[model samples]
Target: MHRLFLCEKPSQAKDIAKVLGANRRGDGCWLGSDVTVTWCIGHLLETAPPDAYDPRYKRWVLADLPIVPEHWKMRVKAKTASQFKAVKRLLGEARELVIATDADREGEMIARELVEHCRYRGPIQRLWLSALDDTSIRKALAALKPGAETFSLYHSALGRSRADWLIGMNMSRLFTLLGRQSGYQGVLPVGRVQTPTLRLVVDRDRSIADFVPVAYWAIEVALLADGSSFNAQWRVPEDACDEQGRCLNPALAQQAAAAIGNAASARVVKLRTERMGEAPPLPFDLGTLQEVCSKKLGLGAQETLDIAQALYETHKLITYPRSDCGYLPLSQHGEAPAILQALGRGDPGLAELLPHLDAQRRSRAWNDGKVSAHHGIIPTAAALSLDRLVGKQRAVYALIRARYLAQFLPNHEYDRSQADFTCAGQALRAVGKVIVESGWRRALPEALTPGKGRETQPAQPLPALREGQDCAVAGVTLKDLWTQPPKPFTEGDLIKAMKNVAKLVDDPRLKQKLKDTTGIGTEATRAGIIQGLLDRGYLRKQGKALAATPAAFSLIDAVPRAIADPGTTAIWEQALDMVQSGEMSLEEFVGKQSAWMSKQVQRCVSLRISISAPASPAAAAPWKKKRKTAPRKASASKGSAAGKRAAKPTSRT
Candidate 1:
């Protein structure tokens, strides 16, 4: 009798099969002499929908507002049921079973669900590994743990799932009913993560809408000399006044600009030079990778994530893709040399820096304690063969590979100089930077264009000078500028905001509490969370920026404050982490979450929602009647084909 092994996805199953000598492949399972490997397309089992428990729920009704179940039931998804059955048969016949899903909460839940649904009573073991590399897989197989060892993780996953269901089901129904009553046609979708994310978009929109710009002025000075001319900016002293002493007078700026214009030439008053060094950026986590890709390449959060996933699961050039921690384990120290060597093979620039790759220099960011289930995303020893990757995967892989190679290079060193000149009565200053050492920036494509403003500028170098030194001014001209409002959030900026939510809040204690909590949703879930808001029509994309819909704003206004606040999610995350760390009981956490959901549901039901009716008579009908109109078929034309391709796959745990 063979030991049956379960993996998360086919790519992972293939890697595990190759390592376990399970070469005889079937539809979804691989047969070996001692072990048979099988895989699931994410989730094979899921919480049963309301309709599954009661026929009345087939048609959503306001009367059936809160469909709370005594015990949530699990159902095998119809699409993957046949594959699940085959796995169940194998498990029943096998002498032992091994779980080899991804090393995370969802992975643990997948194994638990398979065991629960199949009723497999055989001895069970778990194959826990961070990456799909042969060495990692082999080691994991050698020391597989008893399935019970991860019961806590399974419990936590179950708690999260149940909590989401309770809140999602109750609130979704409550809002949908209320929305219809108020004459809204669109589905008022809600979720644990989706609602909070929508609230963020709504809050941001509110801020931008209510923003009041104030008039401010700055004085500009121009100097003329050789072909090179430079400009200087200064603010009028607060004590300075117009003809009248009142500081509020706008004419004071004109007076200052005129006074500076009258000066013949500026004399050197002070000069300062400073040397600075900038370290290479830390390794990419999923959120960081998404942010950078979105900002630099105009990829959506989901698009970037999908590309990163392919790079990890298909290309095998990166570690686990959906990682939150930006740190690697100490054991991975020896692997850096091989990674650098592989990177140098594909990128010509990296070849020059191979000798400088520090095998002994351990980064504090690469600490094992900082890493939880998965390490930071880094390029594997796999050579970059662009031919193997199609569209977005190629782009994402290039980013990961480039970032990994960059870390192995030296720091950027530069000299910055600032000179203050007194021209007649006005003071003017000139700033310049000179690169002393290109360092890691040498690998950057835009490093040479210092002060260009298109890309990040290299540090400036200052010349040595004294107040008495007479340096010829190149030239100068007045430059006009306008004060602009805060820019809207791109997908990248939004991801960064979500990751650093603590910084956005003004309260120090709350900020610290948020820090103590999980920074944001797990990497595996963040993109989906963003997508959910979009699907719900709570958030819309406007030229790569997220803008809140009117309905979303109103919903946030109607909802309880706790539901809209990131701090609440932060607190729950903290408690969940405590459960995971064995610091708090799973029962305690679940009990509290269940109670909170109950309270939130009650609050949602009691809250008054006043939706403005559409101007058209047909559209202005009560929500109940409007909801009967079939939901618009999600058009394949609206989104990329990749999104459509993903829809066919079975949901994963």
Candidate 2:
């Protein structure tokens, strides 16, 4: 009997077919003597809608909820139903099956659900491979594990899916009902991940709204020699300033400024010079890529993610798209040379630096221990093919290519020098620096340009002199500056915040726990989670920044404080990690989540939402109850005004 292969999507199926020598492609499948290949469009089957259980669930009504099913039913999605039926028939005839979905929780769910829904009783094996290359696929096909071995992963995926449904469906309906009861027509949306993300926006807005700027003063001293001038900004001693830097009293800054102003000349007290080495940056993960793209190129999180996905899936120019770790495995060291060679061939600028590439001496960013699930984003052997992409895709691919080429170069080194002078017994200082080596920065030299208010001063190496070097006081200028409030969250800033949620917590142990965990969500899901908020109208993008909607902020306020805080999600992530590692039971982790979902559902039901009524005619109707009218009789007078009335609310449960 032939082995049947199930792939996640049609593109993957085609790729695998090419690699497996199943080149004879049929309508919905490819067949070879050794294997038969078929594909799924992400998910061919999903949990049935509430209306599927009973006709009464066709309309929205609070009385029909908490629509809990005894055993959740599954149905084929209409668009893909025919293809699914074909796969189901193939599965029935095959003696063995191979699950060849992507290597992740959701991917595993897709495969498992297909097997269950299709009642595939044949012996099954899993095709787990990271890359879609010929070698990777061959090796995976050679050592497929029994389907039973992945049961735990399936259970975890199931728990996640059920929990999301329980919370999202019930809470959304509850809020919608509450809104309608209050004369609002807008949909009140809610989700497990989206709500907490929305809270981040709302909290930041609150902080910005309540921010008050206070006046502060700083003193600067200028020293001159040979018509060259350097200035140093002043800072109050730690003991002189209050805890909040109110300066203990404003008089202190006034006195210090006056003392410096009264001096005729200052004596050179001390001078120090230091050399510093700046290491190359860690490799780019999805979050870091999204962040840098947003800051540098003004790309949104979703935009960056899509680009990365295309670079991985379409261009084959990067490794797996969704990765949290910014480090590569030690085993991946040997492959660097080939990747660099490929990059050099694609870009002439990079080809010039090929001589300096060091494959043997590994950077700290390439450690194996730091990597989990997937390694840092790196260029594959695929050359840059800009002709294959347009718009955002091209921009994102360019970023990944630039970052990957930067890793193999040398470190950026600079020398820092300080000059000191004293006037009227007061000490003054100035700092100057020069680049020692452009290093990796040579790849992206424009990044080193100083911003506004920053002046490039000559190195000014001091002539060998003792402490008594006489220096003339240059013309002094007082510069006034006001304190600024914190900047708003851009997509990049938000990704950084999510990855480093530990910094937001006060407790050291708790902070460490969050750090040890991956923080709120995996790199793969974070962008999608953020987009879900935008799509649901819980958050809005104003230019490049994210701000919470009123309904979003209100929902966050109404929910339990812990649920709204990232700290809580951080803690849950820590627990989830423990479960994955077998330190904690899956049952325990899921039990806690279920309880949390129930509580959130109750909270949503109890909370009040005040929203303006929707202007659309379809949204203005009141809740209605079904009548004992026959469909034949109702249709006979369909054109009549009475017959055109909307259907009554149905019982989903």
Q: Which numbered prediction scores highest in lDDT against the true structure? A: 1
Give the per-residue lDDT of model 1 (tens digit) for 1-653.
Answer: 56888888988999989987889977669888888899888899889999988998988776676666766789988999888887778778888888888888889999888888888788878887766667656767788888888767887787778778877777777876787777766455566766777667666665555544434455555554443455555434547733422234456656656666665566778878778777776678899889888877889899888877777787677888888877888878787777676777766655566776675666555677787777788877766656667677776777776666666667778777777877546556667778888766655556221232532223333345567755453333333333334555677787877777787777788887887566556678888888756655556676787766555667777667787777777677777777777888867776787788776776567566865322223222324433434433232222222222332323211
Residue-pair clash count for candidate 1? 19
Worst 10 residues of 2 by lDDT: 633-642
Clashes of each: 19, 5
Of candidate 1, the 10-residue stretch with the lowest lDDT total is 635-644
- Runs of candidate 2 with Cα error greater than 4 angstroms are 51-70, 133-151, 242-265, 385-391, 418-420, 448-467, 506-512, 582-589, 600-607, 612-653
Off by over 4 Å in 1: 51-67, 121-123, 139-149, 224-229, 238-250, 347-349, 425-427, 447-464, 470-480, 612-653
Assess the local accuracy of residue 457 in candidate 2 as a C-alpha lDDT between 0 and 100. Answer: 41
lDDT of each: 0.69, 0.69
Q: Give TM-scores for every candidate, taking all chains together and pairing residue i with residue i.
A: 0.86, 0.84
lDDT of 1: 0.69
